[model samples]
Target: MAPTTLVLNAGSSSIKFALYRAGDDVSLALRYKGKLDHHAGDVHFRITDAAGRELTAPDAHGHADDPTSALLERLEPLLGDDDIVEVGHRVVHGGPDFVEPVQVDDAILRRLDALSPLAPLHQQIGLAAIRTIMRTRPALRQIACFDTAFHHDMPPVYRNFALPDLGADIRRYGFHGLSFAYIASRLDAHQRRTVVAHLGSGASVCALLDGRSINTSMSFTPLDGLMMATRSGAIDPALVLYLQRTREMCIEAVENLLYHRSGLLGVSGSSADMRTLIGERNAGARQAVAQFCARAAEHMASMMTALRGCDAIVFTGGIGENSPEIRASICDHLAWLGLRLDPVLNASGAGVITCDRSEIVARVIETNEELVIAREVRRLTQSRH
Candidate 1:
């Protein structure tokens, strides 16, 4: 039996884990995959082995109220008697300094700590999970697989802000690096320069050239690109100032509104789930889809400008990969821009979702960020030998 790599992506209320075996291909054929969900209330953890058989069912974690503590306490049983060699974490924001997958140590922890304020809600949970697991097993080797690392190759124009370089360190640190990287590796052979749409609650667009990220819609943070399910993406700073002055809204309050309040949910006054909105025949949902289409069209245009005109467009994530109506609407808006869709191909669930003979290509591709992090974890662990 090969040593296994444990990859974790800890969220505010959930922790997802995937176990992989070490092999010549580095993809440690899958050992198990599972998640502990609803930790803030009734906790449930489930795991399944390589052939998708349930190794463990949704076991209850009846513990104290604290999620982190409860999680650590419950994880003890699942981890014992395991031959896991190293752990890799899906860290949300590594900032500029961590431009690649890195083995976490005291210095790395400090740096991840410093960047927490930029992504207070997401990064801290990942860091806390790392610390919790470390304390549980002090000898375990740990690695931080960044969500921003893949975008580090973007040029200065895409990475920098117009503000003076002194305080501009807080500019254009794209999230979803692993998501985008997975998409880039699988573009259709015909795609030259392409646009990738990662449409979920936390969504953003990226332009790729020869499989490297040339420019992306997200800037400085995930909050700055296309309008997302609940996030107010690409808002003017002046509007933020206006809210501050008129409403007496503090920075934190404004941040919450931008990061958690203003997207399809804000516009539709409906649920954030795109499927829910699409099924209901209400004015709000209609209006929400309209606004979403408009914003996505605008962002796609912006990406085209950045890429000097892309040869293809790919969609991924919850909304991008599944919502056929949303995809059709978005492509309808872009028809004037030369992206013709083949309805047959688009509906067949083929890996290629675009229409025939379209000038600019479009398709739906599955993204596997956890798998990417697993690969990196395995690489770093092997190098330790």
Candidate 2:
């Protein structure tokens, strides 16, 4: 059996995994994709082949030290005889230290753990998986592919803040870079000036000029850009202070409120998922969807300005690629900018959705962050040999 490469993206309650067959020439192709969703006391594990066919329905129950260990235990037997030679992780933050993907070591793990405070929701979970992999497969090489690395070279002017006393290292370090990088790779010559809107539960917009990240909606933290499913994005600092003084809320409570209880859930008093919000025929739900569209449209215009002018707008992520209604709404708002969407094409899902006569082109492209991670793993590991 040829050696396979495993790519892991660990979230707070979910771990997305992909296995790839690495060619002798350093090319990578996805073999299997799966996810483990742990909620309450139940553990749901499912795996599918590259063609979306179910290969195994493994019985995954209970938890060990963490979900990573539990997931690895269930997945080991399902891999058959394929040997996993290397592992790659989608680490959300590398701070100012790491500008490229690096092989994991003891000191590197410690440095990544120290960055937990910057990205509380993501770092801890990712580290847990990394440690679990280390314990389980000590012989396997692991790589840390940072989401912040792609935007590390953005212009200093856009990266800086207005604070006078702020240190040189403190600046806007954008997130969703892996997604942006994948989208940037798919752009053609005419789409040099593109605004890619990645509208998932956690959303952000990025402007790429000649495939380089010039500006993005996300700032120092992922919570600073577009309002997400549960995150209150881009709120005034004064409001937080007012809540502390008047509402007697502590720092932790305020953080919890903003990061876990706001956005669509707080606004609609319903579920956080966009599909749920769209299905509900209520004022609150409708208003919630409307607010998301409006805020996304507003940020997209700002991103376009960052590119001087937009040649094309590419939409990816959960809501961006699937929800035709949401896409139409956002395009309608940008109609004044000479963007015209074909209803038939938009509803059909994928490819160019814009009218040929439109001044600007719009496309729907599915992002593959795992492929990028796997490629990086092969590149970095092969370079060492």
Best by lDDT: 2
Clashing pairs in 1: 21-28, 171-220, 172-219, 172-220, 341-355, 342-355
Residue pairs with clashing backbones, model 2: none
RMSD of 1: 2.5
* Candidate topping TM-score: 2
TM-score of 1: 0.91
lDDT of 1: 0.79
Residue range 1-385, candidate 2, lDDT tens digits: 7789989988877888999988887988778888888888778888888899987675577783378778767766757887888899999998999889999988999999998888887887888888987887788888999988999989977788777857755889999999999999999987889999999988999999999999888888788889889998888889999999999999999989988999888899987999999999999899999999999999999998888999999999999999999999999999999999999999998599998999999999999888888988998988987
Q: Against the correct fold, how does model 2 do in TM-score?
A: 0.96
List, residue by residue over 223-272, the lDDT tens digit for candidate 1.
Answer: 77787788878877899899999999999899888877788888888777
